[model samples]
Target: MIELTRDADVAMITLRRPERRNALDIEHCDALREAVEGATADGVRAMVVTGEGTSFCAGADLDGVYGEAFRESLYAALRATLDTPVPVIAAVNGPAIGAGTQLAIACDLRIASDTAVFGVPTARNGLAVDVWTMRRLVELAGGAAARRIMLSGELFDAGQARHYGLCDRAGDVVAAEEWATELASLAPLALAYNKLVLNSPDAGVEDDRLSAAFDACWASSDIEEARAARQEKRAPLFRGR
Candidate 1:
């Protein structure tokens, strides 16, 4: 599900499940982390991630979305993408929904094609994203836009994403690779240090009190309602508890 290719100091990771619209699962997520590690180990100075088909990533596969194992793998994949030694850019080609948005925000920068759109419908689905994902969303997309995405479940197009600071440029994978190649030519240590400080865990974190609230969202009754609603092919009834 994850494909890694290297051209000198630049590496590209493609989500190759076109048949599934690059929807992620436990195995796919694990493979994604491995791809990042492999690219970094190969001494790449920059990396890029783009999906194989019309959709960047549809979201998490619904088959095993409720399980803890899937959650762990998903977070691990996201963590590896953000914590990569070198810079990573997301070349969003189409719709990036739910975990898709999480994956895009996990990168250092994002370049979106005209077809690109981003949404986090976690509130409607009753599933909650990790705190790290939330922090990054707010950091890149800004506080008000993040609230609209997380609370009101709005979708932003490529132009809107660029306007809101979620997307650094309005372009496709080819353009993203050009940026990555240029970034690779710069001083490696300097780039790494800047990325490290910017992506550091303590940089934009909230107080410990919010930690409990995040955990509660994952373990809430609404999550169970969401699962049942999905199995029954109905809209979720989330009572914010």
Candidate 2:
């Protein structure tokens, strides 16, 4: 199940099936996407994804791990995180194995608690993640580390993940939400543009949309607010214009 709540302008999405260590089944995956979408629709500036209880997520529930339905729903949930206009942070509190790892990597940033562990045991299960997931893993964790996770089913603790750049910080959900709260104070349009360009880095040399976004940021009134605030020695109040 998915439980969504809010902290000021930051949305919190928690995976709540502690009974199975919050493992993803088809229904849970669908609910996750819905929670993300609903929060986005409500105009949150940032979001934090986490799991309930001690475990972040064990893996895909073994009963549905071998089925096509599970795969589709799983990727759909991941895509919801990827496609959100605002940034999402993963608060990994414990073992994020298999699909759990995919979910964590899908977020813009990750904060792994000291008790957290990350791994993809696909090879052990005789299964494989999608090309996009693999590429994203390589992008965030680098190729060698990605290979170690996939090929050897190696689990990295919070410290190791931070060393490998997989986890941006080592802390619990509180730290993740604190970061998101800080992010909420920034200019939304600029953050959205950054996310856009980062997600589609090779949007072509002559990409008009990219150029437009760049120009928009420059032209936004938030820039003026920033200038005035700087002159006054105060933080800019960005209106997302």
Candidate 3:
């Protein structure tokens, strides 16, 4: 289950199936994708995703883990978060294992509670994640740290997550909300372009698409507003134009 709420411009998505540790069932995954899509369409400037109770998400439900439908839905939900125009923050309140780790990495930022733990222990279960997921882990936390987590099948705590760069900060949902609120106040167009560039597989390549995005940010009305605000010694009101 997913609970969607809004605090001004920040959208909050809470995984509500605590009895199962918010594990991803096919229906739950579908609901998550729908919630993200709906929230983005509603023009939320930022988003924070967390889980209810003591676990952020305990990965996929065992009953449906081997089903192709569940995998498809789960990956779709992760992709929806990755493709959202606005920034997404993961508020990891507790353990985030297997697919739970995948979900967190898909977000633009991760803020983990002191009690949170992270891991991708599929290797221990004789399972394997897709190449994209593996690469994402490496990108976020570096190859050595990724290997320590996946190869050893070890769970790392919040402090270790921050040190390895898997999580941006160690705090609760409130801290995550504070970061999201700050992001919501920034220039939307620039943030979107930055996220697009950062997430691109060929980010190091010089391409027309990348060039266009760069140009668009410079040409945006928000750039002018920023300059005017600096001159007036006041905060700029960005309209996302």
Candidate 1 has its poorest 10 consecutive residues by lDDT at: 204-213
Q: On a 0 to 1 TM-score scale, where does candidate 1 land against the true structure? A: 0.83
Model 3 lDDT, residue 24, Cα = 90
Ranked by lDDT from best down, the candidates are 3, 2, 1
Candidate achieving higher TM-score, 1 or 3: 3
For candidate 2, lDDT tens digit of each residue in 5-39?
A: 99789999999999999999999999999999999
* Predicted structure 2, TM vs. truth: 0.96
Against the unseen true structure, what C-alpha lDDT does each candidate score? 0.86, 0.92, 0.93
TM-score of 3: 0.96
Q: In model 3, how large is the Cα lDDT of residue 162?
A: 95
Residue 171 CA error for candidate 1 (Å)? 0.7
